[model samples]
Target: MKKVYTISEVASLLGKSKETLRRWDKSGKLCALREPMSNYRYYKKEQLSFFEEFNNHQIQDSIDIKPQGDYNVLELFAGAGGLAIGLEQAGLKCAALNEIDHWAAETLRFNRPHWNVLEGDIREISFSGLRGKVDVVTGGFPCQAFSYAGKKLGLQDARGTLFYEFARAVQETSPAICIGENVRGLLNHDGGKTLKGMISILDEIGYRVIDPKVLKAIYYKVPQKRERLILVGVRKDIEIDFEYPQPTKATYTLKDALKKGELFNEDVPLSPGAKYPVSKKKILELVPPGGYWRDLPLDLQKEYMQKSFFLGGGKTGIARRISWDEPSLTLTCSPAQKQTERCHPEETRPFTVREYARIQTFPDNWKFAGPVSSQYKQIGNAVPVNLAKAIGESIVKFLNEKRLIEQSEKSLIAI
Candidate 1:
């Protein structure tokens, strides 16, 4: 492994601009070293230890950590089994999975024949029988606005939203812990009122909601720069604490995901992928690896961008081609969409279905039971499997601690 990295290499690795690195150097935040002969700025690999995703042996060891016992999870809104599969990988057994999408439910049942999959609207399902039987209740509830009837947001305030169904499940199951995941924007949705409402609802149901956190997928061995905001609630009656999973210091890149490297044993299997129109393909051919619409020639940029060319913000996702060396940008439901084009690094085409699954850390044998577009949507919307596994391990550790504490109390009472 190389001990030193050039300015450009460091910038790419850290996902920062060269100008930002120079600013950091000036401020002594992440100072670069001067090469003795050339005086060019360079960074030592050791210096990168400050970043949570720095490549390190300790990080690799952490990734090998596993759960202490067999915990059970009841998943809601379990689209395509990304979180369910991840928890299984971390040693948790799935009690049941509920998904509204028929194709997604079929995908789950097709991949894991033994999983109890319930397909329908969440509002119609009753989890009363699962009370005290399930260890955890997990969901990726869609963010929706709650009716502000009073100063305090109550359960009824969220009645029409998907989050209401998630909260209802948690109340019905009365699990030791409940986890709800959403997009990062949820933190500030409706000016942060939506999340506050959720926290209040969980509190009313006797679960103490932890301060929500956004886990970056790249820090958890996922080969994409995706982010998911995780909300954890522990039963207030349980005298135990729940901690979010610690991020690993090692990061995987597109190469690890698509090629035979640390993340996979074999190269990505080829499958059907979305294609760009002839006119769009010609425009993307000009964009190099790591390049976007802004990299095109002046006339072509204007022609391709049209009104977007004059837009203020950097529309970086337009005509973007992923680089093999870096983690891929967060995937969208449709790879060929004009707003969120995820073009291949070497080819003018979008990533194949298998490649999409690979980026999301799905195992090679796990197949999606749906059309190509549906498969892409499922993979794109999923919480990266590696990230979910890391979280599952943390939940297991918490459950073990709770069990030990209960055992100690029981022995004292016996004495």
Candidate 2:
């Protein structure tokens, strides 16, 4: 690769626009060089190291870290066993998983026959029996607005929402720690009141909520640039501090996800995938790898994008073709949607089921038990396996430290 890249080249590499690059240069986020003769701006290759894709390496050291003992986990809103499998890989045992979707529950049961898969509305379930037996409680609770009756938000104020059930589970199980994950938008949802309400409710339940942090999937071996906000709470009685997992310096790209390389031992297997309409396929064919609707000719752009052509934002996901060199954009439940098309790099079609699983870092052997569309939805909604495993390891470390402190205190009292 060249040591210096032009403005357009850097833009394409970063999946951003030239105008955005200019703004970054002005703001000192990513400075550019002015050529002596042509007065053209260029970026140094070393400067690109700040991005995850450029810094990716084959060695992944964190995968070797193991749990100290047989810690148990109770997962809520578990979808297709993504988080469950990851925790299992980190040496944490899954005591039970609660999910409402029938197909998702079937998928979980199909893969792990031994797991206690509870398929029903969480509001109907009682977690009191698991109290003191479970060490950790984790859930990917949907973000919903809580009715703020007053300045202070309580658990009762959140009734009827999924989060209320999650809080109730924590109160019932009285686990040492609880983790809640949601979309990155949750951090700013309802002008930030929603997240604040959630924190207050956890406090009311005797768990001290940690400052929420959004974790980037690409930084944890997932080949997609997806973000999830993580909310952690430690029981008030425990003095030990909880820590979030640190991001790995290495990253993976589309090639590593689909082709035989470091991320997988074999190439992606052929499987069923969604197809685009003939008209949509024709338009997408014009878009080169890593290009979107903006790359089309003026006449074609207007025809394909319609009113969106004159829209304010980039609308960059329209008819987009992913490149092998870069990480993929976040995957959606449906790949063929106009707003978020996930077309293949070489072929003019949407990614296959196996390809979708690979991008999420799922093992090839893990099968979905539903229709093709249902399979896509299950895979799309899952937490990336690698990202979940990283968090699981952190949970294990925290629990282990707490255990040691308890044992030492017991010995001191005996003396």
Candidate 3:
């Protein structure tokens, strides 16, 4: 997992000659970074499109695990039911979903009337009634720092945080397995103490926590280059191992997301979208496809970026225009936000609502219930539907194995 590569190393990795790379750099096809002290040209691991190894895992055939019998999932912090939809598609039933947001809850109830959408604060809800009925418990809890006391952090130390609620639900429901998902930054939050604390808390609650994994959405049929850190725990009594859904060899791009292609059967439906202010629009119009603030002319770059222009590190997301051939950068809670602009390749405006849904792999028919800004937040914060389905399939596989083991043990006892 090297983050920066020398030109020669990149040439070897991409199976290209140094001369060709130099030409591509000069042509702006594959930009190379220059070392500040040595001025030596290098390539960032992400800039090399042909190198799939940067995903940091072996690509395997897609998984197709089916449930052995009816399996039920109890979802928490279930914003708009993205995970629930995916799990349902993978043959698991959604027994209940608790979302604190009124709009997200309304969206879930609107789409799936049968779903038990519990709207309100998670802290006020109780899962003890469904203790043994739920096969799995899933939540995308917000990451927060826990007060440290000893070598191991306990559940009580995480009180007042959303994660505590998630852990509490897991303890109360007593499911065969539990899952927690969060942004990739969670791995390093609080200099890694936050994740370690979570692991220790799960361990204390009669569950064996697995090493967390950051699954890239691009490898799981998602058109956007999003990543989610997945934390999985198995109840101590279950001996079955849970494998992450294997990454697929296939890749997708913005074109696949918005046009009639493999990712979608029809072009993205027409819908309302955010428009850049005239001043921002003027600057972005100068940027070509796949280009960012650096692509702008010197004066415009300075004007558009302001103080950030003088800052270190590549502010590549600013004024970015996504290329049709590339997967979009991870979306934020707001598309029109200056820090992470997601401009359409050809259009000067932001992606429309339906287009945003398509990029997240939501079914075209699935509707959001909220104001335009609220809708964007729901979609942006969601686990991409296709990626969630992949995870769900893996969970189903684990449960299938557990079911078989339990059945065999019962038969042996009878004999």
Number of clashes recorded per candidate: 0, 0, 0
User: Each model's TM-score, in the order given?
Assistant: 0.91, 0.92, 0.88
Q: List the residue pairs that clash in candidate 2.
A: none
Stretch of 10 with least lDDT, candidate 1: 52-61
C-alpha displacement of 240 in model 2, angstroms? 1.5
Return the top candidate by lDDT. 2
Report lDDT per candidate: 0.87, 0.88, 0.87
Off by over 4 Å in 2: 1-19, 22-29, 34-63
- TM-score, model 3 to reference: 0.88
- Summarize candidate 3's per-residue lDDT along 193-261 as a digit string, tens digits: 999999999999999997789988877888887889999999998887799988776667789999998
Clashing pairs in 3: none
CA lDDT for candidate 2: 0.88
